[model samples]
Target: MLGRLNHVAIAVPDLEAASVIYRDTLGANLTQPQALPEHGVTVVFIDVGYTKIELLEPLGADSPIAAFLAKNPSGGMHHVCYEVPDIHAARDRLKKQGARILGDGEPKIGAHGKPVIFLHPKDFGGTLIELEQE
Candidate 1:
Protein backbone atom coordinates (compact mmCIF):
# COMPACT_ATOMS: atom_id res chain seq x y z
CA MET A 1 0.00 0.00 0.00
CA LEU A 2 2.96 2.31 0.02
CA GLY A 3 3.31 4.42 -3.11
CA ARG A 4 6.64 6.14 -3.64
CA LEU A 5 9.51 7.40 -1.52
CA ASN A 6 8.21 10.71 -0.24
CA HIS A 7 11.04 12.25 1.72
CA VAL A 8 13.87 11.19 3.98
CA ALA A 9 13.95 12.92 7.34
CA ILE A 10 17.17 13.81 9.12
CA ALA A 11 17.28 14.91 12.71
CA VAL A 12 19.94 17.56 13.08
CA PRO A 13 21.25 19.17 16.23
CA ASP A 14 21.75 22.42 14.35
CA LEU A 15 19.13 23.22 11.72
CA GLU A 16 20.83 26.35 10.38
CA ALA A 17 24.16 24.59 9.93
CA ALA A 18 22.48 21.74 8.14
CA SER A 19 20.62 24.21 5.94
CA VAL A 20 23.93 25.86 5.01
CA ILE A 21 25.44 22.55 3.92
CA TYR A 22 22.42 21.60 1.86
CA ARG A 23 21.85 25.07 0.46
CA ASP A 24 25.28 26.63 -0.04
CA THR A 25 27.52 23.59 -0.24
CA LEU A 26 25.33 21.07 -2.04
CA GLY A 27 23.47 23.80 -3.98
CA ALA A 28 20.10 22.49 -2.91
CA ASN A 29 16.85 24.42 -2.92
CA LEU A 30 15.58 24.70 0.63
CA THR A 31 12.40 26.05 2.16
CA GLN A 32 12.46 28.46 5.06
CA PRO A 33 12.50 26.90 8.52
CA GLN A 34 9.05 26.18 9.86
CA ALA A 35 8.30 25.41 13.48
CA LEU A 36 5.91 22.51 13.92
CA PRO A 37 5.01 22.71 17.56
CA GLU A 38 2.56 19.83 17.34
CA HIS A 39 5.34 17.60 16.09
CA GLY A 40 7.87 19.29 18.37
CA VAL A 41 10.25 20.08 15.55
CA THR A 42 11.50 22.93 13.43
CA VAL A 43 11.84 21.75 9.84
CA VAL A 44 13.11 22.81 6.44
CA PHE A 45 12.74 20.87 3.20
CA ILE A 46 15.64 20.58 0.77
CA ASP A 47 14.36 19.90 -2.68
CA VAL A 48 16.31 17.39 -4.74
CA GLY A 49 14.66 16.52 -8.03
CA TYR A 50 11.31 14.85 -7.37
CA THR A 51 11.99 13.86 -3.77
CA LYS A 52 12.96 16.05 -0.82
CA ILE A 53 15.01 15.88 2.35
CA GLU A 54 13.45 17.02 5.58
CA LEU A 55 15.74 18.52 8.20
CA LEU A 56 14.39 18.36 11.71
CA GLU A 57 15.61 20.09 14.85
CA PRO A 58 14.19 19.81 18.31
CA LEU A 59 11.75 22.55 19.19
CA GLY A 60 11.81 21.90 22.93
CA ALA A 61 13.44 19.70 25.56
CA ASP A 62 10.59 17.22 25.28
CA SER A 63 10.92 16.93 21.54
CA PRO A 64 11.60 13.44 20.22
CA ILE A 65 14.49 14.77 18.15
CA ALA A 66 16.16 15.82 21.40
CA ALA A 67 16.11 12.21 22.58
CA PHE A 68 17.43 11.03 19.21
CA LEU A 69 20.26 13.60 19.40
CA ALA A 70 21.06 12.54 22.96
CA LYS A 71 21.84 9.07 21.71
CA ASN A 72 23.67 9.98 18.50
CA PRO A 73 25.19 13.22 19.91
CA SER A 74 25.64 14.71 16.44
CA GLY A 75 22.51 13.63 14.52
CA GLY A 76 21.46 11.09 11.95
CA MET A 77 18.76 9.83 9.61
CA HIS A 78 15.57 9.79 11.58
CA HIS A 79 13.00 8.34 9.23
CA VAL A 80 11.91 7.63 5.65
CA CYS A 81 8.51 8.67 4.42
CA TYR A 82 6.53 6.89 1.73
CA GLU A 83 3.42 8.04 -0.02
CA VAL A 84 0.13 6.16 0.14
CA PRO A 85 -3.02 6.56 -1.90
CA ASP A 86 -5.15 6.04 1.16
CA ILE A 87 -3.60 6.30 4.59
CA HIS A 88 -6.46 4.66 6.50
CA ALA A 89 -6.42 1.64 4.27
CA ALA A 90 -2.65 1.38 4.54
CA ARG A 91 -2.82 1.51 8.34
CA ASP A 92 -5.44 -1.23 8.50
CA ARG A 93 -3.50 -3.47 6.16
CA LEU A 94 -0.31 -3.02 8.11
CA LYS A 95 -2.10 -3.65 11.38
CA LYS A 96 -3.54 -6.89 10.10
CA GLN A 97 -0.04 -7.98 9.14
CA GLY A 98 1.11 -7.34 12.72
CA ALA A 99 3.09 -4.21 11.96
CA ARG A 100 3.23 -1.78 14.84
CA ILE A 101 2.19 1.81 14.30
CA LEU A 102 3.70 4.49 16.48
CA GLY A 103 1.90 7.05 18.65
CA ASP A 104 -1.86 6.73 18.94
CA GLY A 105 -2.16 4.91 15.62
CA GLU A 106 -3.88 7.86 14.01
CA PRO A 107 -2.96 10.05 11.08
CA LYS A 108 -1.61 13.51 11.91
CA ILE A 109 -1.23 16.48 9.56
CA GLY A 110 2.28 16.44 8.19
CA ALA A 111 4.57 19.17 6.84
CA HIS A 112 3.02 18.95 3.40
CA GLY A 113 -0.45 19.40 4.86
CA LYS A 114 -1.17 15.75 4.27
CA PRO A 115 -2.17 13.03 6.71
CA VAL A 116 0.77 11.00 8.01
CA ILE A 117 1.55 8.20 10.41
CA PHE A 118 4.80 6.75 11.73
CA LEU A 119 5.45 3.05 12.01
CA HIS A 120 7.70 1.51 14.64
CA PRO A 121 11.34 1.33 13.60
CA LYS A 122 11.87 -2.21 14.84
CA ASP A 123 9.30 -3.50 12.37
CA PHE A 124 11.03 -1.88 9.42
CA GLY A 125 14.66 -2.98 9.81
CA GLY A 126 15.58 -0.48 12.51
CA THR A 127 14.53 2.43 10.33
CA LEU A 128 11.55 4.52 11.27
CA ILE A 129 8.91 4.59 8.54
CA GLU A 130 6.43 7.35 7.84
CA LEU A 131 3.40 6.91 5.61
CA GLU A 132 1.89 10.03 4.08
CA GLN A 133 -1.32 10.24 2.13
CA GLU A 134 -0.83 11.49 -1.36
Candidate 2:
Protein backbone atom coordinates (compact mmCIF):
# COMPACT_ATOMS: atom_id res chain seq x y z
CA MET A 1 0.00 0.00 0.00
CA LEU A 2 1.09 3.56 -0.59
CA GLY A 3 2.45 5.68 2.25
CA ARG A 4 3.27 9.39 2.30
CA LEU A 5 3.61 11.48 -0.80
CA ASN A 6 7.22 11.24 -1.89
CA HIS A 7 7.62 13.84 -4.65
CA VAL A 8 5.97 15.31 -7.67
CA ALA A 9 7.99 15.17 -10.89
CA ILE A 10 7.82 17.81 -13.57
CA ALA A 11 9.25 17.29 -17.02
CA VAL A 12 11.30 20.23 -18.26
CA PRO A 13 12.88 20.96 -21.60
CA ASP A 14 15.76 22.69 -19.92
CA LEU A 15 16.88 21.51 -16.50
CA GLU A 16 19.07 24.53 -15.71
CA ALA A 17 16.32 27.02 -16.58
CA ALA A 18 13.80 25.18 -14.46
CA SER A 19 16.28 24.92 -11.60
CA VAL A 20 16.81 28.68 -11.81
CA ILE A 21 13.07 29.24 -11.48
CA TYR A 22 12.93 27.09 -8.36
CA ARG A 23 16.27 28.01 -6.82
CA ASP A 24 16.76 31.66 -7.69
CA THR A 25 13.34 33.09 -8.48
CA LEU A 26 11.42 31.02 -5.92
CA GLY A 27 14.38 30.93 -3.50
CA ALA A 28 14.11 27.23 -2.85
CA ASN A 29 16.81 24.85 -1.67
CA LEU A 30 17.88 22.54 -4.45
CA THR A 31 20.15 19.57 -4.90
CA GLN A 32 22.80 19.42 -7.59
CA PRO A 33 21.76 18.15 -10.98
CA GLN A 34 22.36 14.40 -11.29
CA ALA A 35 22.41 12.51 -14.54
CA LEU A 36 20.53 9.24 -14.31
CA PRO A 37 21.58 7.47 -17.48
CA GLU A 38 19.68 4.35 -16.57
CA HIS A 39 16.49 6.35 -16.40
CA GLY A 40 17.55 8.53 -19.30
CA VAL A 41 17.08 11.76 -17.37
CA THR A 42 19.06 14.56 -15.76
CA VAL A 43 17.32 15.53 -12.53
CA VAL A 44 17.44 17.99 -9.67
CA PHE A 45 15.49 17.95 -6.43
CA ILE A 46 14.03 21.06 -4.85
CA ASP A 47 13.59 20.77 -1.11
CA VAL A 48 10.10 21.84 -0.08
CA GLY A 49 9.96 20.96 3.61
CA TYR A 50 7.54 18.04 3.88
CA THR A 51 7.96 16.90 0.29
CA LYS A 52 10.27 17.47 -2.68
CA ILE A 53 9.83 18.58 -6.27
CA GLU A 54 11.73 16.76 -8.98
CA LEU A 55 12.75 18.45 -12.23
CA LEU A 56 13.50 16.08 -15.07
CA GLU A 57 15.06 16.75 -18.44
CA PRO A 58 15.64 14.19 -21.13
CA LEU A 59 19.15 12.77 -21.13
CA GLY A 60 18.93 11.16 -24.53
CA ALA A 61 16.81 11.24 -27.65
CA ASP A 62 15.20 7.97 -26.64
CA SER A 63 14.28 9.25 -23.19
CA PRO A 64 10.62 9.01 -22.28
CA ILE A 65 10.70 12.64 -21.16
CA ALA A 66 11.67 13.62 -24.71
CA ALA A 67 8.49 12.04 -26.02
CA PHE A 68 6.49 13.76 -23.31
CA LEU A 69 7.99 17.11 -24.26
CA ALA A 70 7.30 16.51 -27.92
CA LYS A 71 3.60 16.33 -27.15
CA ASN A 72 3.49 19.27 -24.75
CA PRO A 73 6.25 21.69 -25.83
CA SER A 74 5.81 23.41 -22.51
CA GLY A 75 6.70 20.77 -19.95
CA GLY A 76 4.35 19.88 -17.11
CA MET A 77 3.81 17.48 -14.22
CA HIS A 78 5.05 14.09 -15.28
CA HIS A 79 4.09 11.99 -12.28
CA VAL A 80 3.35 11.83 -8.57
CA CYS A 81 5.38 9.50 -6.38
CA TYR A 82 4.00 7.90 -3.23
CA GLU A 83 5.98 5.95 -0.67
CA VAL A 84 5.37 2.28 0.06
CA PRO A 85 6.62 0.08 2.88
CA ASP A 86 7.29 -2.88 0.61
CA ILE A 87 7.51 -2.40 -3.12
CA HIS A 88 7.22 -6.10 -3.96
CA ALA A 89 4.16 -6.58 -1.83
CA ALA A 90 2.64 -3.39 -3.14
CA ARG A 91 3.26 -4.48 -6.71
CA ASP A 92 1.56 -7.81 -6.11
CA ARG A 93 -1.43 -6.23 -4.44
CA LEU A 94 -1.84 -3.68 -7.18
CA LYS A 95 -1.50 -6.41 -9.80
CA LYS A 96 -4.25 -8.44 -8.17
CA GLN A 97 -6.40 -5.36 -8.13
CA GLY A 98 -5.90 -5.03 -11.90
CA ALA A 99 -3.67 -1.98 -11.76
CA ARG A 100 -1.29 -1.93 -14.75
CA ILE A 101 2.30 -1.46 -13.80
CA LEU A 102 4.51 0.23 -16.39
CA GLY A 103 7.75 -1.15 -17.88
CA ASP A 104 8.53 -4.76 -17.06
CA GLY A 105 6.60 -4.59 -13.81
CA GLU A 106 9.78 -4.50 -11.73
CA PRO A 107 11.15 -1.92 -9.32
CA LYS A 108 14.01 0.28 -10.46
CA ILE A 109 16.39 2.50 -8.47
CA GLY A 110 14.87 5.95 -8.34
CA ALA A 111 16.42 9.38 -7.86
CA HIS A 112 16.42 8.86 -4.07
CA GLY A 113 18.19 5.50 -4.59
CA LYS A 114 15.00 3.77 -3.50
CA PRO A 115 13.13 1.09 -5.41
CA VAL A 116 10.35 2.55 -7.54
CA ILE A 117 7.77 1.50 -10.07
CA PHE A 118 5.41 3.48 -12.31
CA LEU A 119 1.78 2.59 -12.79
CA HIS A 120 -0.30 3.20 -15.88
CA PRO A 121 -1.75 6.71 -16.00
CA LYS A 122 -5.16 5.57 -17.18
CA ASP A 123 -5.65 3.51 -14.05
CA PHE A 124 -5.02 6.49 -11.82
CA GLY A 125 -7.25 9.15 -13.36
CA GLY A 126 -4.81 10.17 -16.08
CA THR A 127 -2.02 10.95 -13.61
CA LEU A 128 1.09 8.80 -13.77
CA ILE A 129 1.63 7.27 -10.34
CA GLU A 130 5.04 6.21 -9.11
CA LEU A 131 5.36 4.00 -6.04
CA GLU A 132 8.62 4.23 -4.16
CA GLN A 133 9.73 2.01 -1.28
CA GLU A 134 10.30 4.01 1.84
Candidate 3:
Protein backbone atom coordinates (compact mmCIF):
# COMPACT_ATOMS: atom_id res chain seq x y z
CA MET A 1 0.00 0.00 0.00
CA LEU A 2 1.10 3.59 -0.48
CA GLY A 3 2.90 5.14 2.45
CA ARG A 4 3.29 8.78 1.56
CA LEU A 5 3.47 11.11 -1.36
CA ASN A 6 7.11 10.80 -2.39
CA HIS A 7 7.60 13.49 -4.97
CA VAL A 8 5.91 15.04 -7.96
CA ALA A 9 7.92 15.08 -11.19
CA ILE A 10 7.83 17.74 -13.85
CA ALA A 11 9.44 17.18 -17.20
CA VAL A 12 11.14 20.32 -18.45
CA PRO A 13 12.77 21.33 -21.68
CA ASP A 14 15.39 23.22 -19.67
CA LEU A 15 16.26 21.87 -16.28
CA GLU A 16 18.36 24.91 -15.39
CA ALA A 17 15.53 27.29 -16.09
CA ALA A 18 13.13 25.21 -14.07
CA SER A 19 15.58 24.99 -11.19
CA VAL A 20 16.05 28.76 -11.33
CA ILE A 21 12.32 29.26 -11.10
CA TYR A 22 12.05 27.05 -8.05
CA ARG A 23 15.31 28.01 -6.41
CA ASP A 24 15.88 31.69 -7.21
CA THR A 25 12.38 32.98 -7.76
CA LEU A 26 10.46 30.77 -5.38
CA GLY A 27 13.35 30.67 -2.87
CA ALA A 28 13.32 26.93 -2.64
CA ASN A 29 16.34 24.81 -1.80
CA LEU A 30 17.47 22.46 -4.56
CA THR A 31 19.79 19.54 -4.84
CA GLN A 32 22.59 19.44 -7.36
CA PRO A 33 21.65 18.00 -10.73
CA GLN A 34 21.84 14.24 -10.84
CA ALA A 35 22.12 12.34 -14.06
CA LEU A 36 20.09 9.14 -14.05
CA PRO A 37 21.29 7.47 -17.21
CA GLU A 38 19.22 4.37 -16.68
CA HIS A 39 16.08 6.48 -16.54
CA GLY A 40 17.30 8.74 -19.33
CA VAL A 41 16.91 11.90 -17.28
CA THR A 42 18.88 14.52 -15.40
CA VAL A 43 17.01 15.52 -12.28
CA VAL A 44 17.06 18.25 -9.67
CA PHE A 45 15.12 17.88 -6.46
CA ILE A 46 13.59 20.87 -4.72
CA ASP A 47 13.13 20.52 -1.01
CA VAL A 48 9.61 21.65 -0.07
CA GLY A 49 9.36 20.42 3.55
CA TYR A 50 6.57 17.81 3.41
CA THR A 51 7.28 16.70 -0.15
CA LYS A 52 9.85 17.22 -2.88
CA ILE A 53 9.54 18.54 -6.40
CA GLU A 54 11.47 16.69 -9.10
CA LEU A 55 12.52 18.48 -12.24
CA LEU A 56 13.43 16.17 -15.09
CA GLU A 57 15.24 16.91 -18.33
CA PRO A 58 16.02 14.57 -21.20
CA LEU A 59 19.43 12.98 -20.85
CA GLY A 60 19.82 11.84 -24.43
CA ALA A 61 18.13 11.71 -27.79
CA ASP A 62 16.36 8.47 -27.00
CA SER A 63 15.32 9.58 -23.53
CA PRO A 64 11.64 9.11 -22.80
CA ILE A 65 11.67 12.68 -21.50
CA ALA A 66 12.74 13.72 -24.97
CA ALA A 67 9.72 11.97 -26.43
CA PHE A 68 7.50 13.62 -23.84
CA LEU A 69 8.99 17.01 -24.68
CA ALA A 70 8.35 16.33 -28.34
CA LYS A 71 4.69 15.80 -27.63
CA ASN A 72 4.47 18.58 -25.04
CA PRO A 73 6.96 21.15 -26.19
CA SER A 74 6.68 23.26 -23.07
CA GLY A 75 6.98 20.23 -20.80
CA GLY A 76 4.58 19.42 -17.98
CA MET A 77 3.80 17.31 -14.95
CA HIS A 78 5.25 13.94 -15.85
CA HIS A 79 4.39 11.76 -12.88
CA VAL A 80 3.70 11.60 -9.18
CA CYS A 81 5.54 9.16 -6.91
CA TYR A 82 4.20 7.49 -3.82
CA GLU A 83 6.16 5.53 -1.24
CA VAL A 84 5.22 1.91 -0.62
CA PRO A 85 6.38 -0.35 2.19
CA ASP A 86 6.99 -3.19 -0.24
CA ILE A 87 7.16 -2.53 -3.95
CA HIS A 88 6.88 -6.18 -4.96
CA ALA A 89 3.85 -6.72 -2.80
CA ALA A 90 2.30 -3.52 -4.07
CA ARG A 91 2.95 -4.53 -7.67
CA ASP A 92 1.34 -7.92 -7.18
CA ARG A 93 -1.68 -6.45 -5.47
CA LEU A 94 -2.14 -3.83 -8.14
CA LYS A 95 -1.72 -6.47 -10.83
CA LYS A 96 -4.38 -8.62 -9.20
CA GLN A 97 -6.64 -5.58 -9.20
CA GLY A 98 -6.12 -5.17 -12.99
CA ALA A 99 -3.78 -2.19 -12.77
CA ARG A 100 -1.12 -2.25 -15.48
CA ILE A 101 2.51 -1.95 -14.50
CA LEU A 102 5.02 -0.42 -16.83
CA GLY A 103 8.54 -1.47 -17.95
CA ASP A 104 8.68 -5.24 -17.73
CA GLY A 105 6.86 -5.22 -14.39
CA GLU A 106 10.10 -5.12 -12.44
CA PRO A 107 11.32 -2.64 -9.84
CA LYS A 108 14.24 -0.36 -10.69
CA ILE A 109 16.44 1.91 -8.57
CA GLY A 110 14.85 5.31 -8.37
CA ALA A 111 16.08 8.83 -7.61
CA HIS A 112 16.11 8.11 -3.90
CA GLY A 113 18.11 4.93 -4.57
CA LYS A 114 15.05 2.90 -3.67
CA PRO A 115 13.26 0.21 -5.63
CA VAL A 116 10.56 1.70 -7.80
CA ILE A 117 7.97 0.79 -10.40
CA PHE A 118 5.77 2.80 -12.73
CA LEU A 119 2.11 2.17 -13.34
CA HIS A 120 0.43 2.80 -16.67
CA PRO A 121 -1.19 6.23 -16.96
CA LYS A 122 -4.35 4.94 -18.58
CA ASP A 123 -4.93 2.66 -15.62
CA PHE A 124 -4.76 5.65 -13.28
CA GLY A 125 -6.99 8.20 -15.00
CA GLY A 126 -4.35 9.50 -17.41
CA THR A 127 -1.93 10.40 -14.63
CA LEU A 128 1.24 8.35 -14.47
CA ILE A 129 1.92 6.84 -11.08
CA GLU A 130 5.31 5.86 -9.68
CA LEU A 131 5.67 3.59 -6.68
CA GLU A 132 8.88 3.91 -4.70
CA GLN A 133 9.80 1.50 -1.95
CA GLU A 134 9.81 2.99 1.50
- The residue-by-residue lDDT of candidate 1 on 78-104, one tens digit each, is 999999999999999999999999999
lDDT of 3 by residue, 1-134 (tens): 67999899999999999888888889999999999998999999999877899999999767977877889998899999999999999999999999999989999999889999999999999999999999
Worst lDDT window (10 residues) for model 2?
60-69
Residue range with the least summed lDDT across 10 consecutive positions in model 1: 60-69
lDDT of 2 by residue, 98-122 (tens): 9999999999998889999999999
Q: What's the residue-level lDDT of 99 in candidate 2?
A: 94
Candidate 3's displacement at residue 92, Å, is 0.5
How high is the CA lDDT of each candidate model? 0.92, 0.92, 0.92
Q: Model 1: residues >4 Å from true position, as ranges?
A: none
